[model samples]
Target: MRITRVLGATALLFALAVPPAVADSAPSPSASGDDAAPTTAGTSFRTAAEVEQGQQATASASTGDYLYWSFPADAGQRPTVRATVKLPDAHAAQSWQIDVYDGLRRRQACQYGAQTRTAAQGAASVDLSCTLRTVRSWSEPWANDPLPGTYYVRLTALNVATADLGQPISASVRVGSKDVGGSAAVDGSLAEPLVPGIAVTSKSGEDDGDAAKSAVLAGLEPEDGWASGWWSDRWVWTAVGGVLAALAGVGGYALTRGSGRPGRVPPGA
Candidate 1:
């Protein structure tokens, strides 16, 4: 089947109506919140080798950190494909695209629509010393095709101006049921969480001191929503206490002034 670019763009915009972004080095998500290491870092996977060969499409744009995606294991059943993209220090991507492929190597799903597209592939795109902006997470649906088999999800970055696919990253999924034009089924595959790990890179140079300080500073800094939430709570309690103290003061003054006053002090006695 000839896939029209217009249809693909339409689908992409529909999916990107709600863009999803998340930071790299975040813990993998599971129903239980546990994480498992990715089978292959920064690459696509498939149940069978033949399937992998078909989805090897590349793009021009690269991601700042990393991208995450998932799909249902059953065919014909709707699959929720969640993805995240982190931006450089102050620079953000103009738009992005997430593509889902069925067993036949056809573009089954897509999510795009960002303004800024980065030229670098990984951490280099952003100055890690400062705050990191990211698209958290969003979902898209897929159809049951190729008779309910394995599929892949490719999250591609696009230049908002030129409408070009930059660098594409992808992951694999299995489809179980036989549904089409609809959603995935219960037999769809779910991923295991990633095992936690840390990367220890050395810093030593004329700028080593600055890099070291920056690393330390980043750790001390709060996340995007952390400080706002904390300060809001603090101010709320402070206001409540102020109101209570004012009420207490008024009560105390009234009691003190009336302590020894005669109740029947008349004017014309």
Candidate 2:
């Protein structure tokens, strides 16, 4: 069927007026009041400080130390990471970088923004940002789609002069997200997010970071108007496509169906 870009887009905007149903809405630990203040950065993923969306965090450390911070992301939300580094003055040109990893440690591709930047020699500060694609409820194993879960942001220096090895520097980070509503949501959803479990040592001292899973998996609930009755953005596109196809079919039939009926089979045959 023939369709125009304008019509397709119009249908989409109209369809997006409605949202999708949320399977769960309980807040994640990172979103709770327990972490009312910004948490400190961890040296690694295991110790990474947790922060809420839009909350800012500051850290002081050596030029070569790796700073890690984590935040939660729900389906239909696109999260972005912005970081600023206070480079030590009098330092040689160096490359500073920020990377985001998912629960399975898969590196997420930056959709836009300066994920890495090289500070000119003697530069006082360097700023970098990375915006990731919208999170999906579930994805195929072959696809590297972003999923709802805890995401980590790791910032470090790619190269630095030896003289700057122990130089102290200050850094600040902020993680935020914007809900796309149901525009990007899929038909299916996960029962809960992929929150990794922390290993707690036992009183008997038998296990220590070896193995055990206890963290409860939780899904985000849709907003007030997005109950089960609402529809996803995909449905709008499907409905529009179907309408266009039907119109095309009718037009084709009308054009081909001649005004003159088949000359009545020669009266006698």
Candidate 3:
């Protein structure tokens, strides 16, 4: 009887201890658009600059026009970027595209859905979603790897089918990062920044010898920090250890208190 009671208590304790740890270890669900707010109204990449995670940028452009925005991401972080384009009702149908490029200006593959809208549709806006999993800063010299740096999102109007070349379409872009899990570098430092393509170009009429060298030096400087993976997370391991210790303690106690032990009898009986 005593052994059974002790075992039951141990089991209850274990049950109580595991849930919180699991909850802590699990990644939070992706956020909806409720918190997204437009932080920039600029239409060009250089003017828009870099946007922090969760902030949105609003821009107006026409067909064949490109709108650019940048987001800072760390290694091991999976960033989900979304863009919503509002079309003018005058057009019967339109298509829009979103492309993601790393800091080096190399285009990164993104899973996105093209938006096509018809005049009959009541909804004036269409959404485009792209997810880039696990940002890596390095690979073989010949390999193209998705690096952790400023990821640029380019929104373009593919087909407007309208006579008005100046028709304006509004776009809202948001970036969200979820820590999938990975260990940081041993030194806890970020990899080299990828140099922008135009960093070394001088004015049309002038030539500058230091442009290339300066750009290279700037790329070596760390722009963004590192993100830790699951292995580097100590709290999760500690929680796991606690659960194991509890289970082991219960097992050991059960073994010490033999299953065949006789039950205690009342003195009156």
Better of 2 and 3 by TM-score: 2
- Angstrom error of the Cα, residue 128, model 2: value is 0.3
TM-scores of all candidate predictions against the true structure: 0.29, 0.65, 0.60
Model 2 clashes, total count: 3
Q: List where candidate 1 sits over 4 angstroms from the true fold.
A: 1-41, 44-72, 110-146, 160-269
Candidate order, lDDT descending: 2, 3, 1
Best by TM-score: 2
Instruction: Kindly report which residue pairs in candidate 2 clash with one another.
Output: 24-220, 24-221, 25-221
RMSD of each: 23.7, 8.6, 8.7
1-269: candidate 1 lDDT, tens digit per residue? 12244345445544654223312322123332213322333344332122121122122224422332222232222333433444333333444445555434555532322223343533323211111111111112453232223344555445533322343333332211211211112233223111011011123324465554443211211112111111222344456556556655655565566556578878998
Candidates sorted on TM-score, descending: 2, 3, 1
Tens-place lDDT digits, model 3, residues 184-229 = 2222333344535333432321465565445432222223344432
Per-residue lDDT of candidate 2, residues 166-253 (tens digit):
7999988877766676568676765445566521313222553333323322112233422232355667667766766766666666
The models' CA-based lDDT, in order, is 0.32, 0.72, 0.59
Model 1 has a clash total of: 37
Report the error of model 3 at residue 14, Å.
Answer: 6.6
Q: How far is candidate 1 from the true structure (C-alpha RMSD, Å)?
A: 23.7
* lDDT of predicted model 1: 0.32
Residue 17 C-alpha lDDT in model 3? 50
